[model samples]
Target: MASRRIDVRAVSKDPTGQVLRALYAYASPDAGAPCTIEHDGRSIAAREGEPIALSLLGAGVDTLSRSVKFHRPRGPMCLRGNCEGCLVRVDGEPNRMACAAPARDGREVRSQNSFPSAQLDVLRVTDWFFPKQFDHHHLMVRYGTTINEVMQSFARKMAGLGTLPERPAEAPLPEEIDCDALVVGLGPVGLSVALALAGEGLSVCAVEEEPFAGGLVRDSLQWHSRDGERLCGAEASDRDLAKLRAAGVSVRLSASACATFDDGTIVIQSDRALWVRAKARVFTNGCHESVGAFGDNDLPGVYTARAAARALRYGVRVGESVLVCGDEDPALDALSDALSAVGAKVHRLTEGERLLEATGSSSVSGALVGRDERSAHKIKCDAIVASTSRTPAFELAGQAGVEAAQDLDRQCFASWADELGRTQRSDVFVAGSVAHGGRSPVRESAVARSVRDYVTKGRVR
Candidate 1:
């Protein structure tokens, strides 16, 4: 796994070239400011706003952390912060989400839950000892009550998080503010809701975890319209964001909504603490890309479709040869094309073909695909982009009293919402994949009408 940065000039003439250029413009030589971060005692160049996970991966340093019990290697599964696979210690802080944190010059980053190093953990013997399952209760029973104390002490030493800081860091004071409506996500649906509400003379506050506001729009190569016009996803998102700002919608980037209360209080965390009190809350947090359950799926070079797109957009070299396999969808097709445009040899598995396992040691070297349970073949490649259907991001909605049930047909959890995006709670609503469990036509007018009625009428229908 040698460190390598993809050459941006190779894809300069491609359609998605503008996206890669815009994403990595800050890291360019002409771009001012030297941003270099130290990881595992090695200095790596980084962009001002680029995620630390991408920077580390670009430097050929995968295996951000090790599994707690078996010490198995883990890398970034979802470029978004939904998955804990990319947890790392940053600047003496343990268990920090690398994918969510921006790389800062002079910052020290290290992997957690591994002795020696994440790539070569000595505690990996635990995997061999407990090959099938890891139940401490069962282990204790087998050893007898006499060894209880010894077992407890050994378990505490073996299975634990990173070491605590010698001195406690100062916590920032909380800032409180009030608004007419609070939008929890800044995706297309969330942006639309904010714009529509703000246009109606209501004060709005929208929060997004990502540094940018477009959500998936920023990752797509080109969006085709019914009128036969090809538009870049990032450009469209920027246009919409501008409209929201013009309408007086307060936007918070690189901020996460930590929690929501029944009393209409929303807690957000970024550089500081922000407590927002709003009359109505709208959740358009979208969905998380689902990873398939296969052997070595957590390998360093195995990426989800969303993660692969993010890596390419950031001009990170995922691999020279890649295997794209997932549920049959246009998004998968677009990602394959995008990877090929970026000079990577792209190979796609047939629809309905199941990925049995990712074959690799330190990094993915190939993928095993099969049409049936017994028949399978190996495809040689340096990387594997694997994904299944997306699961609705229902955590915020669930906190606000929305109900979610498993949708067996879709193979994901689906939230219950009316056509107008209204949930069980009168003050709460949902939109986009968070409401539908999958991609659907954006019901802009319907969501807008519902929000207006809720704000004006102040009652749940």
Candidate 2:
């Protein structure tokens, strides 16, 4: 990680190189005004729109904090705000997710939960005390109730989410809104679902957590077919966004659809609360990458494949020498190639090989990979990029009465919809990667048609 990009764009001159250039052009974050932020009272230079965590990682400030109870080192794992590895105090706000917070000028960031500093925490001795494990609830239970209560208090004090915010948060203004269809997430599937519905003359409203549409499209290699010419996912996103706006679809960026009530009302949390009662709901919440299981996998420099690609897409190299380990997939292969095209030396762990551990002190330096523990060998790397099948983001869908069944292969629960993307609930439907075992949904058009029919035939009129 460095303060400047590696400038690999100039070196790539081939056709693949041209494709990389186009992708990088689209994947990169807007280089906003130069700004400086204070980390633990020290200044770090960063741009306005880049995430604080990325800025810190680029500055080589990896150890975000120690584990809550064990005090083991922790850092950014997913880099998508889904993991607790990147929690830090931002401008007096305790337990703020660094990846989710932008690096604005004059922003103050500090390591939370750690005793003295994140790097040199005296409280890490707590991990040494518990060679096996520490159970605060049963620590002094046999002694007396009072002693148990005191132990619990000490544990609470040590858990360290820091403190309350400096200022109270103002309550969000609430609004009651109705739409023909409400779509959650704006990834490829969500965008397509929304587009199809709007194309059919149904009023569409789509909500995405990220400020941008096209979730992993810009960072990862995905393409769309448009006008007989293949467009990269980012280009597709731009075109689709324009088309959506032209069709009067309200695409709400930076909005998160959090819950659905028993009365079929979906609660979308953004700048304002939207109690959206759509005639039909299209669940396209997409999915989140998993870090998988391995020893010391929580180390700072280890990242999910997509997360590493996202950092690179933002023009930040997680490491100069990267190790990628996982079963092969088209997206995973593209990302590894992208890493190499941008100057990182990548080593791909072959099939049947498994990661035994990620070896590092406070951050990842190498990964131990092999078919079995006995044959495991350490491969030197500053970053370990793990590629695994993503898990469907099915929590919000569950609130909409979408049944999720456990998939043993991916080792997670996935949203299951009928052949037509109809969930158990009539008013709610699921599409895209959220269904079909986290694969492509069966024809987004069918899902959109189902929603449009609901809108036209139901009580909406």
Candidate 3:
């Protein structure tokens, strides 16, 4: 199937009813090679390098997975792996993340935690039967001992991600590496820090959880980076990623740094464990996007604003009629306009307006929104894009002995940092969104310089 073309520079203000929930050719996206994959015994064709979620959704498979307990419908809420909505079994591997895993020819994708099929899961009756909550422990005890045991057994079988892998896989021995500075993310800020440290002749090793190095900045669609890069969206990330490689900075992709020790050792996990001991550690890890409580909040069509926008690069229209809500993120404006460009009616709830409830059975069909209790009204929409305060990813740094406190004004957990990104821990520093300034060029650059200076003064030891 062919796709409709939408350009960021020349987007139309008028909504056109031309999109058909199929692939769209976003302006000059250097698309990957076409490949085929098997989904639940059916064949699907999509770009080779695109994520499994995009490939499956483009093939008209909407219900990706069923909720564990209630069996409510679920789909890709976050194109990134932060949300657990897109979990699926792949090639006999249980609980593989569809949004993070890339598509390959002959790869088998199947929905898990559903009986027979995700589309027609009879298990969803549990949602209706127990409108409040299902107390499995005391559910059948009133009947008898035998009946209670049986109910417990059924509940046990119904829970969990999926069965074990096809076979037990062998574990590899951990690998160890040494570097002058360890940068934990590869977003525009992370890349800038890595490049700056490398320029000072320090050995830098940057680790990114995404399969590719560039971060969500590229996914902003229309918003540009204010990090003094003067580049917008994909251009900023593309150039910085190239620079990181040319400068000989070792970058490990699709890996996460799991732990940090007092002795300056960090453990990273991927296919294999990596023990990295660096003189200084800089965390540029970004924040997490979230949504608020509402009716059928976990429905298949509810997506974080940035998450839905990220899929557009690969031509995945989240929904034809989308209700943009919650935080006023800069990216939401671009998302609203981009959706408008491709035949979607974008309804953005302004200040004082809020989403009261999301309506739909399997996926969102409309939303109830209002500025006050008496002002509520329903807007017909197929998708609901929601966002809240961004919580800085600080668990890894906190494990390294840094402190974090929740910001009431911003409603996020922010790390305490001095002028040079110094945390409570002397050897560990933080930058990027993890720090206070929120993705500022000055913040990232100053922290990188501090790391360079510490190493230059032989303070690393």
Q: If candidate 1 were superposed on the true structure by all CA atoms, what would the RMSD be?
A: 2.7
How much lDDT does each candidate structure score? 0.78, 0.77, 0.77
- lDDT minimum window of 10 residues, candidate 2: 13-22
lDDT by residue (tens digit), candidate 1, 289-387:
767788878787888887887787677757779998877767778777767766778888776778898898667888888986578998898888887
Task: Report how far residue 34 has shifted in candidate 2, in Å.
Answer: 1.4
Per-residue error for 367 in candidate 1, Å, reads 1.2
Q: Write the per-residue lDDT of candidate 3 for residues 1-461, one digit (tens) a residue.
A: 22322333344453432221112323234457778999888888777878899887776666788888899988888888888888899989988889988899889998789988787789999999999998886788899999988888888898887889897766788788899999998887789889988988899989988866667766766534545645446665666788899999998888788778865554545568788889889888878867777777888889888777776667766777789877667767767776776667789886788899889888888999998669999999888999877788888888888889665556677676777888787778888777755544345667777887787785532
lDDT of 3: 0.77
TM-scores, all candidates, are 0.91, 0.91, 0.89
- Model 3 per-residue lDDT at 345: 76
lDDT of 3 at 421: 84
Off by over 4 Å in 1: 12-34, 144-146, 224-230, 405-411, 437-442
- Candidate 2: RMSD to truth: 2.8
Angstrom error at residue 205, model 2: 1.1
